[model samples]
Target: MKQALLILGFVLFTLPAFAAAPEKSGKSKAHGNRYQAGFTLESPEEEAEPPEDNGRGVEIPTLVVPVFEDGRLLNYVFVSVRLQVADGVDPWKVRGRTHYVRDAMIRAAHKQSLGADGNGRALDREKAAKVWMATANETLGGESITGIHFLTVDSRS
Candidate 1:
């Protein structure tokens, strides 16, 4: 009975020490400063803006260019082009001129030599992209396109 009373007294005395709230330390303030010290907390209402359509761009239909070698037909290359317009530019304005844009792209593709040594072998993608960019800018009467992305280029030989 005396040992039980001692144990009960020891537990009662130690329990209050464990239950007490921890004191703030200088190290805690230093650690907190290392992360997000100068940052202001934003309310939920301030972060509720709608997502912007940054990647909403226009895609042109596939273009087929015929490759020939010495009066003989070789194969055709199918190319898909996408144009990303600059800010404040109306995408529909470019879309409405699809016919002219397609014509310009076709003309540009035809000018590129497919083969390594002009033997009508493969698609000249780099040259085609350059020419297409130039032609599209000329057709649009201004530099409205921010970038030209080639989505696909397939050759059937």
Candidate 2:
């Protein structure tokens, strides 16, 4: 049992050395770009039953947030995102989804970021809408954006 434990300890220590060893291939497939982040878009799920709407706008399903940011109230920052088309989705459709996802993400993030405030929900709605419209008009049309840029706005008095 003592010998087995010693062998296990030796193996554990040596395993990291194997991970740190240099690759044999001179030409690396891995490029050294720190700015890039991985993103995945999952295909839309098949609905068993279609959503029902009573004439106004479609009801956005409420997502239950389990965590909230712990901090003092700071200046509200609005992010103006500009998106460029890459793969499957077209420019116009991508623009629309960008708008939708931007709204969804902002609402979701704000709920977490501003949960402590009494007026958090109200402020997020008003500010997010303004930012979304401004970004859509100014950044979406005319010039084609190659990617996304988020500009922040301070709403603290």
Candidate 3:
């Protein structure tokens, strides 16, 4: 019959697709059935670590401070900083006390302005870096960090 021929044609066309598929190297020996997926849940070979806290240094939350001039409210500058760990200091210890460092830096930044030096429209990187480094060092009670590096400094009016 035509219906039987059509079914035979459909099976002939689809059979090669299942036969051509590579077999899964699972423990199950029942590879005869293509519909059987005897897969077991397997854990990943290794875990991934956070990008910033990979024993290099600690990244503080971005600091958003107001840039003011002559009692006028100017644009806010967002400062992102990273503290490099000292050679002998444990990075985890410094990382654990990061909140203190951030608080001290925020207080210092509130006291000091990070406005432009001579350009009058950009942040003074030199002065800002010094303030951040000094505050972090003082807060950690020793030279817990080698230095403070500015990651980003931008302003929006």
Candidate 4:
């Protein structure tokens, strides 16, 4: 191990290209600065631009729903959802009503199969989104939410 490490150190640090000091020979043009402490010209730093106005969104807690085949329990699929709010609708207001959304989702999951193809497969996203949309609008008393994004649908057996 010591021999191997010594050989590695020799190959790495002793290479003229990898040398940390200014080159004695004029071969320093190929490899840019390899020196740790030596002063070198750095590329210009990029200025951070302000973010564009994307509309609001609300996140709901993940819910676990059972997956079954032929009326027997197989495993659980964890569903995470995020609601995209319509323009002029407050996301925090939707966030405050997330419990209602979460409750409705859980109840709907119990009442119906949200999975597309069972056995560790993805959920039926369109169907699930429909349920979320209808439930959120009904609970919030308006169509405040424009979109339902299924963040994740992981099946565990």
For model 3, state the Cα shift of residue 62 in Å.
Answer: 0.6
Best by lDDT: 3
Number of colliding residue pairs in each model: 0, 0, 0, 0
Error of 1 at 62 (Å): 0.8
Expressed as tens digits, the lDDT of each residue in 1-157 for candidate 4 is 9999999998886796666567588765677655443222211232122233364867789888765555766556777667788888878887887898889878877777766674334456677789768878887877788877665565664
> What lDDT score is found at residue 13 in candidate 3?
99
* Comparing 2 and 3 on lDDT, the stronger one: 3
lDDT digits (tens) for residues 1-157 of candidate 2: 9999999999999999999976888687877567533322212242122233222222222222222335444334333333334444355554445545555555555555633246442234344444434444344343223333222222332
Estimate TM-scores for all models: 0.56, 0.29, 0.61, 0.59
* Local accuracy by lDDT, each model: 0.69, 0.42, 0.72, 0.69
Segments of candidate 3 deviating more than 4 angstroms: 1-54
Sort the predicted structures by lDDT, highest score first.
Answer: 3, 4, 1, 2
Instruction: Give candidate 1 regions above 4 Å deviation.
Output: 1-56, 68-73, 114-120
Candidate 4, superposed: residue stretches over 4 Å from native: 1-55, 117-121
lDDT tens digits, residue span 7-69, model 1: 999999999998884655645433343422232222335324323446646788988877666
Order of candidates by TM-score, top first? Answer: 3, 4, 1, 2
Candidate 3 lDDT tens digits, 1-157? 9999999999999999999886676665654654433322212222222235446678998887666676665556777777888888888888888888888888887786777755443567678778888888888878777766666665555
Q: Assess candidate 2 and give its lDDT.
A: 0.42
Residue 138 accuracy (lDDT) in model 2: 47
Residue 38, model 2: Cα distance from true site in angstroms:
36
